[model samples]
Target chain A: MATKRAQKMEETRAKLIRAAREAFASKGYAAASMDELTAEAGLTRGALYHNFGGKQGLMQAVVDQIDQEMVERMLVAQARAASRWEGLLEEGVAYIEMALEPEVQRIMLLDGPAVLGDPSQWPNQNACLLRTTQTIQALIDEGTVKPVDAEAAARLINGAALNAALWIAAADEPHAVLPKAVEAFRQLATGLLQTEG
Target chain B: MATKRAQKMEETRAKLIRAAREAFASKGYAAASMDELTAEAGLTRGALYHNFGGKQGLMQAVVDQIDQEMVERMLVAQARAASRWEGLLEEGVAYIEMALEPEVQRIMLLDGPAVLGDPSQWPNQNACLLRTTQTIQALIDEGTVKPVDAEAAARLINGAALNAALWIAAADEPHAVLPKAVEAFRQLATGLLQTEG
Candidate 1:
């Protein structure tokens, strides 16, 4: 039950976000031109300002959108896994691979933190971090993981995975680097698994 | 062996670097003004440009100075510990605590990466990362750590420690957050310990 004006407003906002994402992904946040973004969306500077309150607001919206998509992708990866531990591991690897994507790598991982500040302080909420903590908690409860602090474990693991992705992205031979990063991550995660009563 | 002129040139560079570090630490790289920095150093703007090409160049110099000092501090912490593994852990925790310092957190951790692009690609060299890799390799060689990939493990553990420090820096009560981060790091590192043949 939306009015015609409301529907048009929503469309304009979404259009601007998509346009801004493409700009920010390719050129980065600091270098991306507001004019180029507005033109790319087939809108004017007024439209961007009116819809987003300015460039910073637009970047926040872009971050929130990308963050939600990343969380959804992780959840799907987790569901596809055969075991809870496998699910956690699979979700992590998926996150690493997802971070390898140029758009996500630039917009979400690098530029996002630099432009918006710390991930924990982000206003949109870190759904991906939440999902990670939940999976670790489940593993601890099932005795699959050691009795470690779940949130702490999640942050450490997430940090490691993020850096691994950055390594792959920065490497001249990402293909060669991918397997090494994955194996290293596996070893780290496996160390957290419970070996005895 | 050195001329008086050469000695004066070295002093000028050091003075400018110190002035710029103070400016960048308080106001960040983008906001820091080159004119003010040179004036504060009691050096001419020409001296600033001659010694360091520009603002970006000055920040790079500051980053190198801080990075070297950080490695030195970590080495001292390691030497104080009884065992190599304990030394590595102690160095990591010391690193986390050092990162809590406003100057280190702002100049090195936050603005350093933001201005210089990825830490892996910084032109000054990541001496801290190299030290961590060397320590891990030594531990592996001594059979203190498992025979895992050394560089990979170093990158993962470094990433975890850096994130934990950032977490503390962002916390409202860093004192409360510090213990949780350290314990979580211990749990993660303990997982990496060699448990069996």
Candidate 2:
């Protein structure tokens, strides 16, 4: 049994988030306004404050939602692959795909760093990096990758992959940029791994 | 003896660029105001218009300044190094150092993507990538590195290096990040270039 007040509150929060995403995506984080966001949501300042503490809170919520969606998608891709290399390839491709997504790309890569206080402390970045490092560690343990510093390698690869994504996101023709980036990544990955002779 | 109008125009254009850099660095591209920019430059709207077409033109000027600085620094480092590996390492380190500089990092990596109409048409990115490819091609021709797709390899390495710069730029304690990223880049570069004995 859901209370009417609680249901209404949840609905208001959801609407605020949707509106915030649209505003942030279109206007970017720095240019977006609280008034505009509230107007888009068709909510009042009272409703906004009652839901999110402030603009920063609204931005954080948006980042968290996008991060969760990204992590879920990566996990699914990782699960579907036949081998570690294949899994990593699929994960890389999936990441590039996520970067091409308009709303997700805007929220996580573009606006996230600008709005979030410190990128090192950014919840989404840290989580994604950790996940990437763990996956690379698993590959190393499985004898698929060379015995190197998994954390460092993960950081390098993740950094490169993210840059590729950002490039595609900023490009005029994202489709063309993505395939070229993915191919370069695949070649780099092949060169990196230690395959049995 | 320069004409009065020409000299005044040069000064006004330089002032506008400086002001625009500060504004874009601080408030970001979308958030920065044209009115505020003119005020900061100590110039009138007419002066701004006469110098640069508008805010977008001013931003382009700022980007051009940053691009020139980056290319010049890399060229100097490459000239000083004794070997191709040394040149590449110095160039990588120089890039990381440049990324630490206050306005350079923001204007180039952060706001450049945000404000610039389309990244593919960004002259700086294209020029830098081509220059790096030429460097890589030279190394390959000298038998200093394995022969591969020079342009693609350059893009991958450049993309990785740029993202490393972006990561450092986005960090709270940039000093702490630079060493780790540089070490990672060093290893990646060594792994990339070491020939089979």
On DockQ, the leading prediction is: 1
After superposition, which runs of candidate 2 have C-alpha atoms over 4 Å from their true positions? A1-3, A26-40, A54-56, A139-149, A169-173, A190-197, B26-40, B117-120, B123-126, B137-152, B169-177, B190-197
How does candidate 2 score on lDDT?
0.74
User: Which residue pairs show backbone clashes in model 2?
Assistant: none
Q: Can you give the lDDT of residue B27 in candidate 2?
A: 80
Query: Taking the tens digit of each residue's C-alpha lDDT, what string does model 2 give over A1-197?
Result: 89999999999999999999898888777678888789888887778887778887888988888777777888899889998778877787788788887776676766676566434467665666677788889988989887766765676776667767766777777787677777767766664576467
Top-lDDT candidate index: 1
Please provide, for model 2 over B36-123, each residue's C-alpha lDDT reduced to its tens digit, 9 standing for 90 to 100: 8889888777887777787777888888888887888998998899988789778877877887776766677666665663343576
lDDT tens per residue, model 1, B1-197 = 89999999999999999998899888877678888889998977899878788877888999999988998999999999999999889988988999898788777766776667778788755888888889999988988787778877888888888888888889899998899888888778876677667
Which candidate achieves the best TM-score against the true structure? 1
Q: If you assessed candidate 1 against the hidden native complex, which CAPRI class would it receive?
A: medium
Q: Give the TM-score of candidate 2.
A: 0.82
